[model samples]
Target chain A: MQGMIWLLGFLIGASPDSVAQQIMWRVYNRPSFQDMHAQITMTLIDPNGTQRVRKMETWSKKDPKTGETKMLIKFMEPADLRGTAFLIYQHKDREDDMWFYLPALRKTKRLAASGKSGAFMGSDFSNYDIGGGEYEDWNYRLLREEDLDGIPCWVIEALPKSPDVEKKSGYSKEIRWVNKENDLVVRTDHYDRSEMLYKRTVVKDAVQIQGIWFERVIEATDLDSGHRTVMEFTDIRVNQGLPDDLFSIRALGR
Target chain B: MAISWLMVLLAYTHLGGYLRFESFVRVDSGYQIHKLATTLQLRTTLDQPGISGFSALNLIMDRRAPDPVIFRPIELYLTFHRGPVDLTLGKKILTWGAGVFVSPSDFVNPWDFSVLYSDLEEFREGIEVADFAYYRGNAFVELAFLPMFRPNTYPLPSLQIPVPAGPDTFVVFMDGTHPVLPEPTLKKGEGFLRVGGTWGPMDFRLLAFRGFDRDPDLQVRYVWLPGSNPQEHPPDTIHLRPEYRPVWMGAGTLTWIVGPWELHADVAYVRTEDTDGTLPTVKNPYVYGAFGFFRSFWNDQWSLGLDLLVKRIFAFGQTPEDPMGVNALLEEQARMLNFQYEETQPSLAFHLQGSDTRDLWRWSASGIYDLRAREGFLLATLSYAWADGVSLQVGGLFSGRKGRSPFSQMGRHLGQVGFLEARWSF
Candidate 1:
C-alpha cells in the first residue's frame, strides 16, 4: 500500500498541472461528433474600417480509432480565388500534412512544416492557430479565476516547452480565458517572440449543436497593424457521417 | 454590329463584359516605338435545370495597326449535363495537357504566337468543336471533334526577321505573298480523345490526336534572279510558300505527390506524313517531353517551380556527302522556324512567385534558357493591389544570346522593352 501511494504520487507530479490540465481538457474535449460541415464567411477589416468578405465551405471529420482529424476547405467567392482548395490532415503525435490546389495552374502543391507560422488566407489567424497546435507542446499554468463580462472564467497562461516549438509557432505565449459554464475559450491574447501582445481573439454566440458547444462567431484583431478579421459560421451540421473519400487528395480537384 | 448583337443576346441571357486598354513602348538603340490597344469583351450565360450556355465576344482596336479594329468570337458554347454524361458544342478553347509552361499534348486550339510576350493564357484562340465527356467516380473520358481548321498566327516580318547589311550582300528581303490555306470543310475535321483519372494519390491521362500541324512549313518555290546578273543584282527575291501537313500524335501526362513536393511529366510523340525525309519542305517525326517539380514554402507566401524540356527528331533531312549541302538545307529549315534536328535541343525554365499575407502585393519572375541555341529570355513583374479590383503592374523583359540565334534576333529588334499597366475589374 505504501509503494502504491508513492507511485501514484510520482505519476501525478510528472504530469501537467492538474488544475490547468483539467480546464484545458474540458475545453478541448467536446461532445462526440463524427463529422462537421459548414459554410463560413470571413470579413477582413482594415484600419480605416473598410472590409473585404470571402466565402468558403468547410468539411471536417475525426477518425475515432486513430484520433486523427482531416479538414478540407474550398473557396467559393472572389472570382480570382474561386476553385482553390486546401486540405489538411492532423495527427496526434507527429507533424501535420497539408496540400493546396490552385485552379489556374491545375496543379496541387504541398506545404512544408514551417508553413504553419504563416497567415491563413490573409486573415489575422495563422495556419497553426487554424490547425490547432499540439496541446502537450506547451506548459500550462492556471493564473486566476474571475468573472469576465458577467461569466465566470479561469484565466490560464501557456508557454512553449521547447525552443523548437516556439520557433515553429507565431506566438511565444498565449493567455486564454476559459468559460467555466461550458468549457469554451471566451478570449485569448497571443504574445509575440518579444513578449508583446500581438493579437487578441474573442468568441461569441455560443450555442449547443448535437449536444456540443460551438462558437458561431469569432473575431481576431491585430494589435500592431490595426487590422481585424471576423468569421461567421452558418448552415452548420454535426455528426453527418461524411465519407472518408471527401478528405482525400482527389476531392481537392473536384 | 457587335454591340447590337450583344444587346439582342442580353435580352434573352445574362450579360457581362469588361473593357481593357493598354499601352506598350519600346526604348532601345536610339529608337522609340509605341503601341496602344483597347479591348472589349462581352460575355453571356444562360442556365436552366440541366442545360447551360455561355458566349464571349472580343473586339480589339489598335492605334498603330493597318486594320485598326477587329472582331472575334472567342467562346460560344452550350453544355448539356445529365447524370454521367456531358456534351458541349460550338467554338471553345480546350486545354488538354497538364504542363504548366509547355503543353506538348494540347493540340485542340491553335494559338496566336504574336502575343508570346503576354500572359500564356492569352495565347489561345478558340475553335469550333463538338465535345463529349463521361464521368464515373474519379475517372473521366473526353472526346472532341473539330469541324474547322484554324492555323497558328505568327508575328509580322519586322518582328520575326531582321535584315543586316553585309560587305558582299546588297539587299535581301522575303516577298510578302499570301500562302494557300486549307479549305474549311467537314471532311478536313480533326479528332481528339483523352482518358484521365486520379487513382491512389496520382493523376494520369492518356491522349491521342489526329490533326494538322498548326505551324506551317516553308517551301521555297524559286529564287528570282535580279537583272540576270549576279554582280549587278541589287535586290534578290526569295519566293516561299507556307504548307500545313497532317500529323498523328500520342501523348501522356502524370502527376504524383511525394511528401512535400509534387512532380509532373508530359510527353508526346508526333509522326508526320513525310516519313523518309525525302521532301525538304516537310518536317520529320519528333518527340517532345517535359518534366517539372513544384513546391511552396513560408506558408504559401512563396512558391518555386522548375521545368526541363527536350525535343528530339527521329530523322534529319537527306544526308549528303558534301557538308555544304547539309549546311544549306539546315539554314533553309532554320529560316522556317523549324527545330534544328542535327543537334538535340534542350531547354530549362524556372518560375518564382511570392506574395505577402494580405495578398496586397505580389511579385514573380520567370526565365527560360535554351541550351542548344545558347539563348534565353527573362521576364519579371511586380504588382500592387491598390484597391479590391484595381491593380498596377511594372515589369521588364530582357533577352540574351551568344550567337545569331532566334532569341538574339528578337532582342535586336525588340530590345529591352519596359511596360507599366493599370487594370480595373468589376
Candidate 2:
C-alpha cells in the first residue's frame, strides 16, 4: 500500500511543462524509419491567383547512431531548372549542412548555415521548414488543448531558447497544433523577429503507411507578401533500405 | 547534311527525340534581322544487371536572313556505367571549373558565338571525346581524351570591324589561309585530368590539361611596294594567317560558404610554346585567376552574382620588332596584338536576377566591365511566361566605352540591339 501511494504521488507531481515537452518530442520525432522516397510537386500561388508549379524527387535516410538525417532533392520539371539538385545533412544538435548543384554550371556549391531562414527553391516554405525544424533549440509550452478540423490537437507555443537561435531562425516564436492521434504537427503560426505573425503552415492531408504517418499535402502562406506555396507528396515509399553512397557529394552532380 | 546524319542515327534507335522551335526579331540601328531556329534532342537509356547505357543527341537548324539554312549537331554522346566507373564516347560538351562568368579551366569545348545572347551553357559546341569518371565515397576523378580540336566561330566579316587602315595608306587584301590544325591522331589529341572532392564544408578541385588554344593568333605578313610617288602614297600587300599553338594548363579551384553567400575562386597557369615571348605571332604564357561571390535573397526570388578575373602575361614587352616601312596597317595590327599579349587585363562581371513568386515574370540585368580598357557591355531583359513551355522576352544590349577598346569597337559597328524573342518547347 505504501509503494502504490508513492507511485500515485509521483504521477500527480509531474509538471505540465515536462509532460508537454515529452509530448512535443514524440510529436516531432515520429517512428524511426530507415529511408523514404517521394515525388513532390510544389505550386507557388500569388494573391492574384496566378500559380507556377515545379516537380522534384526526394530521398531521405536517417542515421541510427546519431539520429541525423540526410536528404537529396532533384528537380525534374521545368526545362530551365532541370538537373538542379540539393543535398542536406541535418544533425540533431548542430547546424545542418546543405549543398546546391546547378547543372548548367556543373558545380556543387556549399550553402551557409543562415540558409535555414531562406526560402526553399523560391517557394514560400523556408529551408528550415523543409529540412525539418530545429526542435531542440526551442522551448515548448503547452498552451491548451483544442480541436482543429474535427481532430484533437495539442496547441503548443515554442520560443527560441537563445538569441543565436532566434537570429538564425528569423523567427522569435511559433505556435504549433500537433495532432494527438498521430503526433503529427498539423498547423503552425510563425512569428518573425519583430514578434509579428509572418507565416502560417497548414497540413491538409496525412495518411499512415506501414505504421508511419506521412504528411501528404502542406501549404505555407506568407502573411506579409500574401504568397502561398502548396506541396503535395505522391508515390511516397517508407522504410526502404537506401545505400549510403546516394548521399555523397559526388552523386550530386550525377 | 547534319539532318541526314541525324535521320540515319534515329532510324537505328528505338527511342525518339523531342522537337522545339524558336523565333526572334531584332531591330538595331533601323536594321531588322529575323531568326527561326529548331532543335531536336534525342535520348535513350538501357539498364541491366551491373551495367547501364545512355546516349543523347542534339540537332539544330538555324535560319537567318542572308545566311544559308545551317544544320548542325550540337551534342552526340554514348555513355556506359558500371558500378563506380562511368565511360562516355563520341561528341559531348563538358564544363570544367567553377566560375559564373569566367572559367579558365573550361578549355575542352569551344563556345558557339552565334548564340551570344543565350546562356553560356547553350553556347557550348560538342567535340569528340572519350571521357572516363571514377567515383569513390565523396571524391571523384575524371579523365577526358579529346581526339579533335574545334575552334570557336566568330561573326561574319560584315558584322565585324575590319583592321583599320590609315587615310594615307592603300591596302591590298590577300587570300586568308586557315590555321594548321592538329591532326586527329592519338599523338596530337588533347586530354585533361581532374580530381575533386569535398572536405568538411568546402569543395575543391585540381586539374591539368594539355591542349591547343581555342582562339588563334593572327600573323600578319606584309610587303611595302614603291608607289608612283614614294612619299605621297604608301601601298602594301597584306596577308593574314591564323596559327594555333600548344599549351599546358594547370588549374585549381576552391569553393567556400560564408553567411548568406558562396565564395569561389579559380586559378590557372597556362604555359604556351612561346616561352620567351619573342614570337610576334604566338601567344605568351599567362596566369589567369577569377574570384566570384553568389547569393540569393528575398526568399530566393532575387539572385546576385559578381565575378572578377585577372590575366597576367609572364613575359611582357618582348615582341619582335617590326621592320621599317611596314606601313600604318602593320603598325595598327601590331598595336592590337601588343594590347592583347603585353598587358595585364582585369575584368569584372555582375548579374542581378529577380522573379515574382509565381515565376511567371522575371527581370534580369548583367554587365561586364573591362577594367583595363575602361569599356563595358550591359544587357537587361524582362520575360513573361504566357503559357506552359512558351514565353516571351524583350531585352536590350548596350556598350559604354571611350577609346578603341573591344566594346567600343563593337558598339561603333553594332550599336545597341533591341530584340523580342518567343520560344516554344515541346
Candidate 3:
C-alpha cells in the first residue's frame, strides 16, 4: 500500500525530495509478518582476523492494538552472559523503553532509550540499526538510480533533520541502497560526524518465509578499525502468535 | 542440606557457569601474596511439566581462607507459574530496589561486604523465602516471607577508646565478635510486601518490611575492678556483643529515564527500638536515602555515573545531661558501636568507564568519598577480553583517610593491594 502511494506521488510529479521520502516510507513500512522468532549467531572479527562467536534467541511482536513493537532477546552462548535478556518496546511517537536482566544479579535494569547510537552487544551494529530508525528523523534526498550486480536500486542520501538528531545519532549522513523491486534497504554507508565513512552494512542474503521477506545474513564492518561483525539468522519462524506475557519483565528473568 | 539431596535426585537438563583465578599482592609494603584463590561456579536447571527447578553451586579454593576449601549453594529454588500468578520457594537471589551500587531499600538478603568490589556473585547470599506474586500488564504486587534472619558479613576492627576518670586518660580497646542470630520463630521471621509498576518512562516501587536490621547493634559490656580509676587502669576486657534487633521499615524507589540520562532515587525510613536518643548503646532511628544518575557520552564509548547517599539520625545527641549540646560521649559511643561519624552523614560515589571502538579493551574507575568521615576509597581496573569466554583484568584497590573511620581501619589492615585476575566461562 505504501508502494502504491509512492507510485501515485511519483506520477503526480512530486518533488524529488518528497519522492525520495515516499520511497523511504515504503521501505520503512514494508510488508512483514505479525511476529517472528529466530536464532541468531553473531561473529566478531578483529583486524588480525581473530573471531569470537555469540549466540542468542529473539522474539518480536508488533502489537496491533497500540502500534508498538515489542522484542525480547536472550543470550544463549558465551556462558558468562548466558540467561541475560533484554526487553524493548518501541513506541510510535515516543522514545523506546528498554529493560535489561542479568541472571547473576537477578535484577532488571531500565535504561534510557536515547543511547540508540551505542553499539549493540559490542557488535558493529548500533542499537538504532537493530531497532530501525524513525523515518521522520532525517531529510531524504534521491541521490540517483544505480545498478549493483545487475539489480536496480535507488540510492537515498539522508541527513539529520536537526542538530539534536545528528548528535544523538553520532552520524553526519547516511546513504541507503533501497532495492527497487522489494523496497528493502540492502546496504547502508554510515558517515561519522566529520563526514568520514565510518561503517558499512550489507545484506548478504534475503529469504522469504510465509510470503514475507526476511534478511537472513548481514555483515557490518567498521571502515576505520577494520573490525567486522557478521550476523546470521536461523530457525526463523513467523506469525507464531507470540503471547504478550513473553515480553514482560517476568519473562525477562525466565 | 535438603537442597543437596534434591539436586542429586533431579536429572540435570542444563548446566553453565564460570571458573575464575585471582591473585592480589600488597604493594604498599614488601611484596606479599595478599590473596590467592580459585573459584568454580556451576548452575543447573530442571524443567518439568508444572514446575522448574534451578540450583547454583560455588566452590572456592584459597590457601588463606579460614577453611581453605569452601563449598556452598548460592541459589536453589523452584518456581510455579500459571496465568497471572507466580510462586517461588527455596533459596533465591532477589534484588528489590532500583539503586545500582548502594540501595537503601534493598535489604531482601544479607550482603557480604568482604568482596564488595571484587566478586559480583559472592557479594551477597541468596535468602530462603516463600515468594508469591500477582502481575497484570506493567504492574506487580509481591509478598515474601523469610523464615530466618541473616546478618551481613564484614571485617570488624577493634576500636580504641580513651577513658578519663580524673585528669588523665587511659586507652582501652573494644572488640566485636559475631552477631547473635535471631530465634527461628514465626514471630521472629521477616516479611516484605512490594508494589511496583511502570508509567511511561518512569517506574516506582513501594516496599514495607518487618524484619531485623542486617547491621548489628552492639551491647557494650566491660569488666571493671572495684576501687580502680579508669584513667590510670583501664578495663582489661571490653567486650562488644553484637545483636540483631527488630525494626519497622518503609521504603520507596523511583527510576526515570529522561533523554540520555537514567535517574534513580531510593529512600528508606527505619524505626528502631530506641526512638529517643537517651540510650547510648542502642542505635537511634534513621533515614537512609540515595540518588544517582547515569549517562553515556561520545556515542556510548564512555559512560559516567554519580550516586549520593545520605543518612540522618533523629534526636541525634539529645541526652539528660546536655539538652542542646551534642555530647562527646554519645558521639564516641556511636562511633565505637555503629561506625557513624556524625548525626547527618553523606557519601558520594562516582564511576566512569570507557572502551575502545572494538570493545576488546576496557577501563573503569570508581571512587567513594565519605565527606563527614574524611575517608575515601578508589578502585581502578583495566580489562581485556581475549575471547568470547576468556578474559583478564588488572586492578588496584586503595583507601585513604585522615582519622579513625571504617575505611581507615580497612586501609590499615589491607594496605594498598594490586590484583590480577583471569576468568573462563563455559
Q: Tens-digit lDDT track for model 3 on A1-254? A: 54465578779988779989889987877787789999999999889999989899999999877768999999997777888999999998888899889887788988887667788888999877887778888999988878867767889999999987787777889999988887878999999889999999999999988876788999999998899999999999989888888889878887
For candidate 3, the TM-score of chain A alone versus the native chain A is 0.94
Candidates sorted by TM-score, best first: 3, 2, 1
In terms of DockQ, which candidate is stronger, 1 or 3? 3
Using all chains and alpha carbons, the TM-scores for the candidates as numbered come to: 0.79, 0.85, 0.90
Candidate 3 on B265-374: residue-level lDDT in tens? 99999988889877665678899898999888876788888889888988887645643222445346445546655789898878899997667799998877888777
Complex DockQ per candidate = 0.24, 0.39, 0.61
Q: Would you list the clashing residue pairs of candidate 3?
A: none
lDDT by residue (B367-415, candidate 1, tens digit) is 7788777787777899887765567788777776342334444565567
- Fraction of the reference Cα-Cα interface contacts (below 8 Å) that each candidate reproduces: 0.29, 0.41, 0.65
Query: How many residue pairs clash in each candidate at the backbone level?
Result: 0, 0, 0
TM-score (chain B) of candidate 2: 0.80
lDDT of 2 by residue, B161-184 (tens): 234345544444423345556676
Q: Model 2 segments beyond 4 Å from truth?
A: A1-14, A45-51, A92-95, A105-107, A113-115, A221-228, B1-28, B34-63, B156-177, B219-238, B322-342, B400-414
